[model samples]
Target: MHVATADQHTADWLMRFGLVRSEEHLNHYRRQGFAWMVARMFPNAGLEELCAFTDLNTLLFLLDDYLDHQESSASPENRDKKVKAMIDGFIRVLRQPKYGEQSGNPVFVALAELWQRMKKMSSRSWQRDFIQSIVAIFTAAIWQHENVKAGKWPLLADYMEQRQYLGAANIATDTIAVVDKIRLPRKMYEHPLLQELTALCRNTVCWANDLFSLSKEIAHGDYHNLVVLLSHEENISMEEAIVRACEIHDDQVKQFMRLCRYLPNEGPVMKMELHRYVEGLKNIMRANIDWSDYETSRYQYEYEEHVRTHKVREHYLMEAAV
Candidate 1:
């Protein structure tokens, strides 16, 4: 299962970009084990590609923190306005042909640098796909926030459909080409079986995340996870919901295997690229599991002290939620 050798390359790259301004932020980043997760997800990645991958992951983590904590705490009247502005600003930065200094937001600035680097490093279509995937994520977060505030959780079908963006797996898949320097033919990439394979990979990763973060989400009064949604919508107990969530993840894995048996036929070069992409997805799913299992900081109550505990009881570290 140790698909990749561990390295501190990405952790070191954090400072090179000067993304974290304060000692507090710096300490938080170090504690996150973000770089290691990226490396695991992209087992064969070179230093430069791994660093870029980790940077995007870290940037998204910061944005999610802002949404779930800071943006959520704002008054309802201000929350919607602020979230939209931030989303729009980020979208503009990502969609732009070149980096611009319009937004003072640190995340936006970091993203612009990333966009430039990705533009030069990846194909034009890959760049477009990445932007679209990220934009969907931001937009979906905003919608989810509004739905929760309105006390209206979506139906299971709708939720599953929209969760694609929340998981941000499209961007993760797109990274294979840039990081591995291999490109699958567009037709093979778009084939239905390949799409199903990708959906299974994305679902497994997101569902596992739902299980891992269930307690934290509950304690924060956030109930957007599949586990929470299932329990609430189905009128089932939390224990039952967790079991159901695991079943969904397992079933997806089974389907992933079935789909992998019949991947699209393509030229040798394209077949190799497709194989690499599939392997990349498998590694990403495994990385999510590894990260949640080992890196307790994100879910741990006493992250600084390392109690090796879990869950989101009120007595837990309220400060860690942000």
Candidate 2:
């Protein structure tokens, strides 16, 4: 997480303004590097704008953490019902698209505030797209909860499809447009190339996440991950599953590079817009690894150390061959 002088000035103000009641909660959220990532994504943003961007990510991360895993004493059935209600609350915001903070939940208040800024900054169509992308995340998170309850591992394709939304890549990139003032015309936005670009970034970032978070998820016995899903589908050990996951990341990245070469060469302004969008995608890819590697405590250095160990990989491959 690269912290600019501008970003450094804004960090304390953003934290104080956006944090909920708990001191511990605020500390945890800051530790996740949400503000740092926002500073990178919207490098040109002034203090207020950067704070707003960071607030959305902070709320989203906290919401995800609160909802995804089992932390409460509620029964499985009750937990599912609770998850449904939380997801439905966000879905209602999309369907109705309200302003003014009436909800008691600070998360909803934060989202409402974010939505207000978004509506002011971007087109209605973009807003719709952003909301829909966010809704996809909520829905997929419900799927995660349901999967945990049912004790069923989805196939690799299905898992990837869901985790793409979980990565929130679309929301992240589109928000970049608003914060950075990248005025990509609808034609460019709708182009197959751009869609491919977005999807590839989404896939790669999420799968990199799957790699970085593998040990954490494994320790929790969570199968809502690319590596674990592949392992199940291929009957491979964790190491081999990791090797396969790396292949997925490599393939997507190569496709992204290939597609970058073919991005339409047009007017100077349009080309620059396309270039900015591509750079935003790259920021996402790099930020995920940077945050995972050093910025966040959720993933352990020991996990990465294990990934680098040839013995584990070789042992798994040898066993699989036999």
The clash numbers for all candidates, in the given order, read: 0, 0
Q: What is the per-residue lDDT of model 2 for residues 1-322, given as tens digits with 9 covering 90 to 100?
A: 3354433443453454464446575556566777777776566666666766676676677677767654345887777787787777776765554622676654555566666765776788877788778788877877777677777777777887788887676677777677677888788888999989988888887877878778777777777888888888899987788878877777777677777878888789999998888877777766666667667776663444655343222222222221
Candidate 1 structure quality by residue, lDDT tens digits, 132-197? 787788777877886877888788777887787786766777777788777676777779988888
Q: What lDDT would each prediction earn against the true structure?
A: 0.71, 0.70
Clashes of 2: 0
CA deviation > 4 Å runs, candidate 1: 1-21, 97-99, 301-322
lDDT of 2: 0.70
Model 2 ranges with Cα > 4 A deviation? 1-21, 70-72, 94-100, 304-322
List TM-scores for all candidates, in order: 0.85, 0.85
Kindly provide the TM-score of model 1 when superposed on the true structure, using C-alpha atoms. Answer: 0.85
